[model samples]
Target chain A: MPTDHIMKTYDDELKRLNNAIIRMGGLAESQVAASIQATVKRDSELAHEVVEQDAQVDALEAEVEALAMRLLALRQPMARDLREIVSSLKIASDLERICDYAANVAKRSIALNQAPVAKPVYAIPRMGKLAQALIKDVLDAYVQGDADKAMHVWLSDEELDELYTSLFRELLTYMMEDPRSITAGTHLLFMAKNIERIGDHATNIAETIYYLIHGTPLKEARPKRDRSSTSVVLPGPVAVATTDSEETK
Target chain B: MPTDHIMKTYDDELKRLNNAIIRMGGLAESQVAASIQATVKRDSELAHEVVEQDAQVDALEAEVEALAMRLLALRQPMARDLREIVSSLKIASDLERICDYAANVAKRSIALNQAPVAKPVYAIPRMGKLAQALIKDVLDAYVQGDADKAMHVWLSDEELDELYTSLFRELLTYMMEDPRSITAGTHLLFMAKNIERIGDHATNIAETIYYLIHGTPLKEARPKRDRSSTSVVLPGPVAVATTDSEETK
Candidate 1:
């Protein structure tokens, strides 16, 4: 084949790979949303659907992996072509894990429904929606090949994390006041966490995008001191004692 | 370099990368464990230490990434070498996130202790221990290249998930009984979850290791249908509300 023909062929392969991933992502996004509903409404059937769909995701993951491997072995692609393949592998893994988290949420929802739940099912679904959008935005970024779009998705993670923190506080108090709340409270807490993890998976996709474009990580600016307006405090000066205990353990 | 010299040099470089990763794993594990103690004991200083130590983990992640890039460029190694380098990148990402989860747990601890906690804070610490060891063992499997060990650690994720689920349920029951327990219960929930996330990260590492050694994903046995003989009753049909309430807005 002529050099241009070879290049065109590789590009076509990459296009196919990206499309495959997008299809996989659609399933992943829906899985996340459905999982939230499953838990919120105690719909075990939706949970089963999410779990069963994981197999399809897995099959797609394998297909994409094979395509990526073929490109590497045959074309030895460079630059964006190579980056595209690497991103596919990472995205497949993230999507699979997001599904797992959704199933977990569904499972928890069923558990909480068994006995009267401690509190109204307030923040968990909101958290799930945020997570679902993160997945959607990241996938949109991939489809558009827009780095800025990916960056926007990355920023949303902070808000999700903050929401999770608030939810965590509420749940912890529930457990303490009535020991009975412990069982149902644990289920809700995991449901919230499953949503948080989905956010992390979305961030992973964004991070892969960063590497694909710049060959550098999405370098986070670490705060040297307390950056938040609120002065975040530690428990006490038990660092040494904790260190000793760690040693003994 | 002669082929033999090239072989030994490759081995040496791989060993250095492995050692650095193992050291990073140890540091990450300790960070998770200490963060748990900070939360359970309400030790603000240790919580600060955990937060401060996260920077070190981030730095280590960068160093690993830089080294992996050098190998990719300088060595021009084959697929096996490439797999090893990619595995390192994946593991660094996992470790960095685990550290973030730990820091989160510690931060929550500080928040919880500022007010009177409502529940007994016993299980989170133990969960942290299991999670930290999972990180350690997964790394050990990668370094020693024991696929079996890695698989063993991967299998334990289910048990960890169960523990977190139980903890969640207990917390919810508390919130249901009394409104007063909300805040403390939620904080404890976050603490348990951070530990649980550490276990998930460990599984991510093990999955990466399997890829590195096997030149593919480790063959996962068909995950049997979740008999879900526990709290979640599966196979429930979905019901849709055909109408929206007038107060929906």
Candidate 2:
């Protein structure tokens, strides 16, 4: 094939690969959302669905790996293209692991259903939403190659941590007050912790974006919570860019 | 340079890089161990030592990265060398993150020093030991290029999960029986969870080994725990091959 033809084909392959990863991301994110809903709504069926679908997540990861390997072996991708391809592989693994933690959360939710919750789980649901949103934004950032947006996702981790900490304190109070609260309160804590981990995985993805573009790891990516230069109004979430702020909404 | 000389130089650089990573692993392992000691024994000074040493850990990471980058640019390595170098980058990042978690745990310990712990923290010390052992084994495996040994570290994640679950239950039980246990017990639980995460970082290294060597992803690493065939002696730790089964005296 001609060089132009090959370049065009490689570009197309890269697009397909990114789309496949986003589709996987959608699945992973929904697992987290459904898992939270399973606990909040006491829906064993939804929890079960999350559990059963883990295998599908696993399979998708394998497919992504296979696709990445095929591209690397055939294309001999260089520099930026290499970074983008490698990032996909790493991000897919990270997403798959996120799904596992989400599944674990759902399983714990089901297990805790037998006992009364130690206290109302008001914070966990919000924290879950926040984490899920951060992950969504990170995925959006990646598809659009938006580093700044990815950094925004990175900044969101602290809020999740704070919410998790509050939930931790509340559940501990309930458990301390009544022996019967032990079983369920413990499960809730694990669920919250699992969600916190999901946020960390999203942060990992953002850090990878920094690497893909600059070949330099951001030593500290925690968005300046106090806000100095973080508030850039980039193009709405879909125009792809070679840089980190492209909006792939 | 002749291929032989180039090969010799590349081999030397890779070995040096690997040694640097192992040294970093040793420091991280000590940080976890020392942090736990400080927390459990209320040794504030030891906690400070770990904190003070973290900058050194960060420095080591920077040095290793500079070395790896120089090797990549100078040697223009082939695929296998490329894999080794990339794995070094990732493993260092994971180790650095693990150390950060250890320091965070110690920080929480400092906070908890304001009051006595409600119960003996049996699970945390054990979890730390397990995590340390996993890191030791994975580093050993990677250095030796022993796929089987690496596989065992990968499966060891289940052990961490099981330990975490038991710790959660035990902590919850303490809190249920005593309200004063709430704050201390919750911090302890998060600390234990951090230790468990160290095991996870080791598992990530193991998967990286599989990818670098076999060029395939082990997607079902978690759901199926039967990967003993990849170990050094594992019909039991790796000697049997089960070094982990060695008497914990």
DockQ of each: 0.14, 0.19
Q: What is the model-wide C-alpha lDDT for candidate 2?
A: 0.71
Across B1-249, the per-residue lDDT of candidate 2 in tens digits comes to 698997887789888998899899899889988988988788877877776788788888887877766665566565677677767877887888789778767766665675575574766778888888888898888878888888999887778766765565556556555556666676676677677778778888888888778765565535332121111211111122211211000
How well does chain A score by TM in each candidate?
Answer: 0.84, 0.85
RMSD of each: 8.3, 10.8
Q: Which stretches of candidate 1 lie above 4 Å from their native place?
A: A2-9, A36-43, A112-130, A157-189, A222-249, B1-16, B115-119, B156-181, B221-249
Model 2 chain B lowest lDDT segment of ten: B240-249
Worst 10 residues of 1 chain A by lDDT: A240-249
Q: Which candidate wins on TM-score?
A: 2
Model 2: share of true interface contacts reproduced: 0.19
| Each prediction's fraction of true contacts recovered | 0.10, 0.19
